[model samples]
Target chain A: MTPYDIILTVLTTLLALYLISFALYIVRVLKGPTIPDRVLALDSLGYDLAAFMLILSIYLNSPMMAVCALSLALWIYALDIYVAKYLEAKEVGG
Target chain B: MSEMLPVIMAFVAALISIVATWLAVQERDMLIATLFSALQSTCYALIYYLLMAPDIVLVYLPVSVGILPLITIILIKKTERYEE
Candidate 1:
């Protein structure tokens, strides 16, 4: 096989593995019993998604997609912080 | 060979993240799960780097690894409730 073929196969395999992990993270987010647990799962899933986006950019040799990944990572952080603060306030008041 | 190194690193990081997610879900304690979630972020940062996106990694690593964890810990502290 050619070198390109070998590299392509490896990249595809790795991407597939990452996708499976992402699916598992989704299950955790759905099944989490507590709010904190769900938040944690969501946080993990966000990070994984960022990684996945980066990998896709590399696989496709597109630099523009990396910009999207950067923005998404930043957005998720804000969401996580906001949700955590809201949860804390609710817990304190109740 | 050198170009393929990034793919190899990405593969390793992805595997680490998968295992960490599994452990986070299996752990009963929310605090431990949060810690695992933070670990997953670190692995993801490495994966991002492997994908040749230093800019994205820079933004992601600190927020996911630092800010998110601190916020989660604070929420946990205020709640004082571990289980459902």
Candidate 2:
């Protein structure tokens, strides 16, 4: 087995692990007993997905796809702030 | 295995997306449902990336993951948290 094959195997294994956790996160999102629980799961899923995108870019052999990971990382935080304020019964925004 | 890694990843992501959509609609709480919608959007964005459509991911991330959830949560606050 060459070194390149070893690298590909490791990447595929990691990607499989991420996908498995992704499914587990979905289960948590589904069976969550509270709104906050569900929101928290969703938050983790977003960030996890961004990481998946980065890995995918590497697998795809393209640096351009990394930009999606960057923007996706930036955006999901808005959901957290909005939900927290709404739960606290405070003004969400102007 | 190396040759088909992207295709396999995309398939798994697609399945997750379907499950997320089902969970989102099945929720009794609007807030939780909205959160699930965000998850669904996230899966879609990943699918976009897997399909090599970075441009779509750019628009989808901000609009679907960011703005859509924010607006929906605000509307939920104004309406009702739990559905009857």
Candidate 3:
């Protein structure tokens, strides 16, 4: 009825959707037929998690937590780059 | 409902992380196992956030998800991909 209640409902629904996507990502990671499949799924999972954390921070009234979300977003690409380098170079280090 | 949402979210994230840990341990492919471990760490970060610990989440995200996985991938490349 109230505006706060509307916001709560929307956030809860979004969180549920996020959880569902997380489940799907895990399934892909677990049963993926190829290395790239798993890597792609993990990448998506990390991006989704970053968004989820941002929303969660808002819901929890802790703006500081957004920094974690930003850091997570930036760091996830390192995994992608590392995997790509390993797949290509056949040697991982610089 | 408002008061209990955090608890429920934390519980669900914990469950997901547990499953991820099991999958990681059971996986024979080192690369995939490392990815699973990263997923597990992601869930742990969520749980930490839900518990009102942003500080822990900040520390945990880089170490467990970023550095740990990078190190494991390097090790995998140094050795082999499959466990057998």
- In model 3, what is the error at residue B28, expressed in angstroms? 1.6
DockQ of 3: 0.76
Per-prediction TM-score? 0.51, 0.88, 0.90
lDDT of 3 by residue, A8-94 (tens): 889988887878878888789878999899889988988988888889888877788788888888888888998898888765445
lDDT of 3: 0.85
DockQ value for model 1: 0.05
Q: After superposition, how far is residue B7 of candidate 3 from its true place, in Å?
A: 1.5
Q: Model 3: which docking level applies?
A: medium
lDDT of 1 by residue, B1-84 (tens): 646656775786688789878988887777667767865776687677666666777677668866777777777767764676
Top-scoring candidate (lDDT): 3
> Model 2 over residues A34-55: C-alpha lDDT tens digits?
7788878888988888888888
Cα-based lDDT at residue A25, candidate 2: 83
What is model 2's native contact fraction?
0.97
Q: Decide which is better by DockQ, 1 or 3.
A: 3
Candidate 3 per-residue lDDT, tens place, B1-84, comes to: 777888988898898889889988998888888888888888888888888888898899889988998899889878889987
Task: Return the top candidate by DockQ.
Answer: 2
Candidate 3 regions with alpha-carbon error over 4 angstroms: A91-94
Q: Which ten contiguous residues of candidate 3 chain B have the minimum total lDDT?
A: B1-10
All candidates' lDDT scores? 0.71, 0.81, 0.85
Cα deviation at A21, candidate 3, in Å, is: 2.1
